[model samples]
Target chain A: MSLTADDVNKIAYLARLGIDTQDTESYAKDLSGMLDLVAQMSNINTDDVAPMAHPLDQVQRLRTDAVSETNNREAFQKIAPQVEAGLYLVPKVIE
Target chain B: MHTKTIAQLAKGLRAGDYSSQELTASYLARIKQHTELNSFITVTEEQALTVAKQADMALATGNAPLLTGIPIAHKDIFCTQGVKTSCGSKMLDNFIAPYNATVVEKLDTAGTVSLGKLNMDEFAMGSSNETSFYGAVHNPWASNTVPGGSSGGSAAAVAARLIPGATGTDTGGSIRQPAALCGITGLKPTYGRVSRFGMIAYASSLDQGGPMTQTAEDAALMLQAMAGFDAQDSTSVEREVPDYSAGLNNSLQGLKIGLPKEFFDDGLNNDMASCIETAINEYKKMGAEIIEVSMPNLKLAIPAYYVIAPAECSANLSRMDGVRFGHRCTDPVDLNDLYIRSRGEGFGTEVKRRILVGTYALSEGYYDAYYIKAQKIRRLISDDFKRALQEVDVIMGPVSPSPAFGIGEKTSDPIEMYLADIYTIAINLAGLPAMSIPAGFIDNKPIGLQIIGNYFAEDKLLNVAHQYQQVTDWHQQTPQGFA
Candidate 1:
């Protein structure tokens, strides 16, 4: 149930929360505490039970394939972090 | 004027006792007075007065709806157009919602004036309201005690008479826990009962919005306008919205009540247990039969909830990638740094911890071991509720283990804070309707008697709460200073 420093780094990387050497120890302790909490469930055998994905057995609802909403790109992009020329500007990925 | 319930206010508004503008002013003044409570994030005074003037005009023409001109403080979780819907997190601190959430739009259409945004836990994560980036909301009953949260601000404001009624979203007892501690009435309708179109996502499977008010009748009136089907929300149930106000006077004769044995174990506070026992006896005297029920799987609810909620939240919050909308770190060398720092800087400790845990649970190798195991136990918990519900009309229990605790009491330990919701989370897993009504007080703080019912049984739940409220005066008792 204990998470190692390496394990903590992997989790931090997966979750996309910046973690350095100092914070990793505390993160390890906190996460290990939680992992121990969930580890108890593993003891009770759930061999035949189906995993409950949702409270209700709902189908994936579909609507007619047609454009319903008017274009509000200008309104939506106004809140973006960095947008220019009607496009979101993210960090350089390819270049 | 501030102490009047929504029902009374609606009546007075129609009778021309006062205009919506006058009532709106009173609430605004009190919001200014109770700055120490930290209950509100933004008081939209100018917008409220403008809406109130329109409501007054509507009421004068004798063409007003049920809740026309009543003032309501909305939870900051909902997206109110042109207002800051922070959800008590720095991630969305700069987020000024461009469009109104469905709850906001529906309430506005009914002519209820918006008093502004109420505070909440950071992304509805904390049991105590202390997780808010805006600062923790103080319990109205005691200045130093924490108001039971996620909906802490909504409950505190209503108890302090800052607003007669307010809207709160309960992911895992957010609405009910605060309502209990603050000596107010709150309802969390069956999952999918209310539209979640624009309500900020916490755990998509468990989130449901309902009313937090002084009386069950007021809750009914507010809920009538709030519940409905929407094309926007994928999980919104397509059903007829009953007249919740009409069922308030239904007789409680021969009502069957089940008290879950698991809820009253050795961990329960003695004082809170006594108060709940007294409330149950009151129900028995009102011609309701009480029976002992067993929900063996209820013990696993907290663990299962923590796992399921965090996992869902991890997926849901992935939308906040700094590029779209929210706080972005300065001078990012690459997208990875942008994602990491923006989220790291934006979220608080508890939020980050949950995100990390969720990512671990949902990651490649551990998915089957943790996430699937919790989901399986979730089925057992749901089955337990389904079985117990068949034997009884409703299940009764404590909304929380004890009344409101000191603000910093459980802040250092997340597990202790999570255990506070041990009595309440299973209902969300079962997707049933439940409520916390003011039962009594423990050491000057309030305790709520929780009534849980089967799916789509909100009408019956509200009826029972209203009947109990009729016989007891607990819901009528306001905090000393506030009164």
Candidate 2:
């Protein structure tokens, strides 16, 4: 149930988060500790129980496909780190 | 003027005893004077004064709302139009919300003056306010002690009389834990009771907005304004919003209070047990019959919660990538580099730890073992509450394991910090309405008596807390220097 340095790196990569190389061992220890805590759930047999996603057991209420929001592109993009012509700019992926 | 409750302030404003402008000024001055508490992240003084003047004009017409001109602040988690809504994270430190959260808008509609945004744990993650990027909020009772948090600023500010009341959100024990630590009243309404539109999401299923105030009466007033259905938030409940203050004076005669035996075991502090017991004794005198109930699944709450909350947080926080808004890295070689470095630089240690854990838990080959397993345990914990509440009107217990710990006491150990929420976390898992009221103090630190009720039982919980407040003066007791 314990995580290793390799597991920590794999998790960081999957999460798309950068972790300092020197901190991997410590992160491994912390993550493993959490796994140990979470491991306690094994004591109970929940094979017959249905997984509850919502607290009230209510399903998502769907609505008609009508447009309910107005375009506020200018206002919305005002806080972006980089934007031009109503487009959010990120690193070039296709290139 | 600063010591007056929201009810008293509202009455005075209407009766011409003091203008809303004067009250706003007084609270603004107090907030400025207590800079050491680090309770507020932003103070909207100019906006508050302008709004107070307008409130004064509305009051003159004799038809203003009950909360008219009352100065209050919001937890930084709520998006406030044109105001910085940090959620106490460096990622959003520079972000100004384009629109108001439904809670903020509703409060404004009720004519409550906005004092500004209070600090919180970064993205509402930690139990202690120390996780906040702005800095740890000092407990009003003891400056060296930690103010219980993610809603630490709201609790501390209200306790220090910086603001009469403020909004707080509880994902885990954010609202009630801090309220108990700071010796104030805080309520976490049932899931979806209050609209979550524009409220920065942490754990969507578990997070709920409520009032952190000096008394249950004030919390009722705040909840009356904050609770309702919103088209903007799909999860918003469509139930009727009852007059929360209407049942404040209701008799507790024949009220059945269920006490979970597990909460009173050796884990509870001796002083906290006595204080909570004394509070229950007062309820007994008022004709409440206490029944000891056993909820075996309660111990699994923390483990399950850690999994579910972090899993949700990881998905929700993924939107904080470098492109659209929030922090972006100075330079990036590629898209992956942009996301990885931006998130790594923006988020704090605890937040990163959670995201990684969530990533691992939901990854291939482990989703059922960790995520689904936690969900099943969540149902078991919730069912335990259902069984207990079926037999009693409400459940009463300690709000926190103990009073406020020293600022650095448990910071080195995350597990210890998580365990501190043991008494309060189960209620959130069940999505039940619950409250923490000032029961008494131990070693000058506050202890809160938690009153948990069935779903959408906000009125009942408020009534129970209000009746208790009527007989006790603990909620009235302010920290010495602040008073």
TM-score, B chain alone, candidates in order: 0.99, 0.99
lDDT of each: 0.91, 0.93
lDDT of 2 by residue, B203-225 (tens): 88999999999999999999999
TM-score of chain B as predicted in candidate 2? 0.99
lDDT of 1 by residue, A34-66 (tens): 877777787788999999877787776899999
Which numbered prediction scores highest in DockQ against the true structure? 2
Error of 1 at A76 (Å): 0.9
What DockQ was computed for model 1? 0.82
Q: CA lDDT of B480 in candidate 2?
A: 83
lDDT of 1 by residue, B215-264 (tens): 99999999999999988999998899998878889888899999999889
iRMS (Å) per candidate: 1.0, 0.7
Rounded to one decimal, what is candidate 1's iRMSD? Answer: 1.0
